[model samples]
Target: MAGIEFEIMEHIGKISEGKSGWKKELNLVSWNGNDPKFDIRDWSPDYTKMGKGLTLSAEDLKSLKNVLNEMDI
Candidate 1:
């Protein structure tokens, strides 16, 4: 596979941290210089590496927010 390119447009927040100095975070990212999107994934301490994660568009993010708001807990 070809190398993936990405830019962290915004650092939203950290969800959790692991013992390996990797942290699960939510951020806005642009893949291959395309438009930015909401991303949730794990990144190494220096951000030189990342794990598989989910990417969502603005519409999807709004839907997710609605779902979360409706959840009892």
Candidate 2:
């Protein structure tokens, strides 16, 4: 299976109740070192239908770290 990694850029807001709120905008990036072929603008993940928030498996997180380490970027 092809490995995938996700990165999130969030804009956080501070609430009057002394709580922090974040809106996560995600980017699914690949380490292939080439331009992405698909359109990211059309990409969407319906967390409500999936019954979960954004998350990754342990193995996937490890792989992503490895890729980043190897690239040293």
Candidate 3:
């Protein structure tokens, strides 16, 4: 299945700033040389109920913005 890809730097930044509760929401799929990938479906509370996952929460977006603002990103 085609999946969304995210940069590791961005991911770590989000984790550090609590922008995404990803650690609690999704599982990390790592590779040796290839870029890591994540299945958005895995993060959803109702994966079977819906065809796709929910968007990031407003609080999460705000937190992400705060993190990005604080850092050079």
Candidate 4:
């Protein structure tokens, strides 16, 4: 059977711009996919590249962001 591809999370924003080809940096994400959970990763560079990253709970993700933002930098 044929299946369709869909996005799991809503692309909220990117922490920074990536270099040319296969080198994306941090990304800000929100879940909107099937059985969604909080995730963090490079988001595959292309159809051939896999982005390195970690997955966290929505609460965890939010707390992490808050802590990072709270830093007096």
Candidate 5:
């Protein structure tokens, strides 16, 4: 059997931090050696673990940007 593979290509920024020091971050990640994508998730302090996350492609990111731009927040 083979194990899943992933690489954190870049550390973008931290969105928030939890009490235990885990951080919710946005990063560029490549899974299974595929192209990198925008990823948002919670990561352990040492980055040895991660929580569920959303991965977005360039087109998806563009759409998200558009929607966010139109938001009042």
Candidate 6:
């Protein structure tokens, strides 16, 4: 199994990853890391590492954003 290459999922300043080969990752890969989709991710911590991950399509992401924004908290 190879390591996952992560791309920043949001404009959270920098994309700081764990120490090399140390802690697991939870990447929100988008556009194959080309024209990435910097949408907020919603899933478990080790989604990719556990062989299963929740991938939100562009529309889905938009809906999620709307929902998040509507939140009062």
Using TM-score as the measure, which candidate wins?
1
lDDT (10s digit) by residue, model 3, range 1-73: 2453433322221122123332233323343435444423223232222124333444665677699899964
lDDT of each: 0.95, 0.34, 0.37, 0.53, 0.92, 0.48
Candidate 2 lDDT at 53 equals 39
In candidate 5, what are the lDDT values of residues 1-73, reduced to their tens digit? 1386789999999999999999999999998999999999999999888888999998998999899999998
1-73 in candidate 2: lDDT tens per residue? Answer: 1354433233122122212222233333332454322112222233111112333444665677699899955
Candidate 2: where is the Cα deviation over 4 Å? 1-53
After superposition, the stretches of candidate 5 with alpha carbons farther than 4 Å from their true spots are none
Candidate 4 matches the true fold with a TM-score of 0.55
TM-scores vs. true structure, each candidate: 0.93, 0.28, 0.25, 0.55, 0.90, 0.36
Which predicted model would earn the best lDDT? 1
- The stretch of ten residues in a row with the least summed lDDT in candidate 1 is 1-10
Per-residue lDDT for 1-73 in model 6, tens only?
A: 2655555454332223344332323344654456554333333344344333355667787898799999999
RMSD of each: 1.3, 13.7, 10.6, 5.2, 2.1, 7.2
Please identify model 4 stretches exceeding 4 Å from their true place: 1-6, 21-34, 44-48
- Please say which candidate is ahead in TM-score: 2 or 6: 6
For candidate 2, the lDDT comes to: 0.34
lDDT by residue for model 4 (6-73), tens: 34445555554467544444433333444555545554455234455675767887899899999999
State model 4's lDDT: 0.53
Q: After superposition, how far is residue 33 of candidate 5 from its true place, in Å?
A: 1.1
Worst 10 residues of 3 by lDDT: 9-18
Inter-residue clash pairs, candidate 1: none
Which pairs of residues have clashing backbones in candidate 6? none
Worst 10 contiguous positions by lDDT, candidate 5: 1-10
lDDT per residue as tens, model 1, 1-73: 1488999999999999999989999999999989999999999999889999999999999999999999998
